[model samples]
Target chain A: AQTVTQSQPEMSVQEAETVTLSCTYDTSESNYYLFWYKQPPSRQMILVIRQEAYKQQNATENRFSVNFQKAAKSFSLKISDSQLGDTAMYFCALGGGSNYKLTFGKGTLLTVNP
Target chain B: DAGVTQSPTHLIKTRGQHVTLRCSPISGHKSVSWYQQVLGQGPQFIFQYYEKEERGRGNFPDRFSARQFPNYSSELNVNALLLGDSALYLCASSPRASSYNEQFFGPGTRLTVL
Candidate 1:
């Protein structure tokens, strides 16, 4: 079974600064996918970024990027130019090639300060 | 375009009762997945349906079940609910159940078992 872990329970960042959310996973599968999801007070889950295990290059989507270290089994999300809108509960998820289901971490509450 | 949508924005039930949650996938999506998000935790996969067939299931007990319709819409049914069952139920859809496809999520149905 694959499991994801987010050590930080809470985080805060000043507006326009950068923040990194840490994530780690345990999986035996060689082919898998890592994802970062955001949930605001509205309770909607939004995809922040995704990274494939096979890709050596990290995934970047505008201000959101991922630092994927396959050997270390770590996939961290980096949010640049943090804004008030970036405040949310961030979760790290894992999906394997054999199964389509996702395994998620407990989540980290991020508060962006103005 | 409309994102994934779930019915009954909020629900309340009691122990030994039953509950049904509905989900409408995005247009052109062929796969729908169900997840349960307990308070202060990440979402846990419950079931995944593709093309109206059961593609995958999580570690949940038999008390939970689901099915997909011809239009790719889906329903999650839970019987003999317990107070622990109170959580937010999320629906996600993808164009197909593939390693490269990223799932889109809905706002989710908040279920409260009192």
Candidate 2:
């Protein structure tokens, strides 16, 4: 069984600042996918970014990027120019090669203050 | 294209009552997955179905069951629900059941068990 862990319970960032949320996973599979999802107060789970285990290049969206270290089994999300709308609970997830089911970590509540 | 959509945005149920949640996958998507998100925690995988066949299941018990229809829509049914079952039920869909494809999520159905 794969397990994702987000050590940070809560994180806060000022508007326009940068913040990083840490994540780590335990998996025996050599091929998998890592993802970061954001759930706002509206309860909508939005895909933020994704990283393929085979790819060394990290995934980056408009204001979201990831620091993926396959060797350490770590995948962290970085929010740049954070906005008030960015306030939400961030989750790290792992999906093994053959299974699309995702194992998620305890979320980190991120508050972006304007 | 339409994104994954779930029905009954919010529901309130009593303990021991059964509850049903619905989800419609995006057009052309053949895989549907269900997850449970308790308060202050990440979403936990429940079941995954592809082409109307059960592909994977998580650590959940038999009380949780789900099925995917021929049209690719899905329903999650919980029997003899407990207080711990009160949480957001999320549905996700992807083109196929593979780690290479990113799963698209729906606005979850919030289930409140009293």
Candidate 3:
């Protein structure tokens, strides 16, 4: 069994600022995958970033990055130059081995104030 | 090409009723997955089908079932619906060529049970 946890229930940031959402996970698989997905008011879940457990290098998108600590089982997402469009519910997920199922956290509500 | 698409944008049902949700994956995508999002929670994986066969399943009850067609389209059926079943059902698809590519998501079907 695998589980993902997001400590922050809600977070607010100003436009152009930077914010980081925290995530931690537990999995029996020695090798696994970490992902951050964002769901906005449009009701669609979009991939923000993903980190492979084997890769020490953190995964990053244009404005989204992740600090993945494999030893600590921490996978946090950082958003720089945040925009209004960044306001959404962010989820941390775990996927591993031959099991294609994704175990997700409860999610953190992020609000970017203009 | 258009992204993943889901049918019956919204639905209302009563306890003991049955509901069916549909999804069409992106062109050339053969791996389809289903998830259920309950209000403020993150989406929970339900099923995954690839090449017209069941590849993975989550912790969901047997009441929740799904299948993929030859065209890569899929349907999720829930029987004995309860108030707890009210949620947003999301479908995601990914090309099988990419080992760990992010799944493209649909707008999701919002199901409300009374």
Q: Estimated TM-score per prediction?
A: 0.98, 0.95, 0.96
lDDT (10s digit) by residue, model 3, range B36-114:
9998888898999999999998889999999999999999999999999999999999997222678899999999999
lDDT of 2 at A1: 74
Alpha carbon lDDT of each predicted model:
0.93, 0.90, 0.91
DockQ scores of all models, one per candidate: 0.74, 0.72, 0.63
Cα RMSD of all models vs. native, in order, equals 0.9, 1.3, 1.4
> Candidate 2 chain B — worst ten consecutive residues by lDDT sum?
B96-105
Worst 10 residues of 1 chain A by lDDT: A41-50
Interface RMSD for every prediction, one decimal?
A: 1.4, 1.4, 2.4
In model 2, which regions exceed 4 Å deviation? Answer: none
Q: Chain A TM-score, candidate 3?
A: 0.97
Poorly placed runs, candidate 1 (over 4 Å)? none
**lDDT (tens digit, per residue) of candidate 1 on A1-114:** 899999999999999999999999999898998999999987688889999899999999999999999999999999999999999999999987788899999999999999
Candidate with the greatest lDDT versus the true structure: 1
Residue pairs in clash, model 3: none
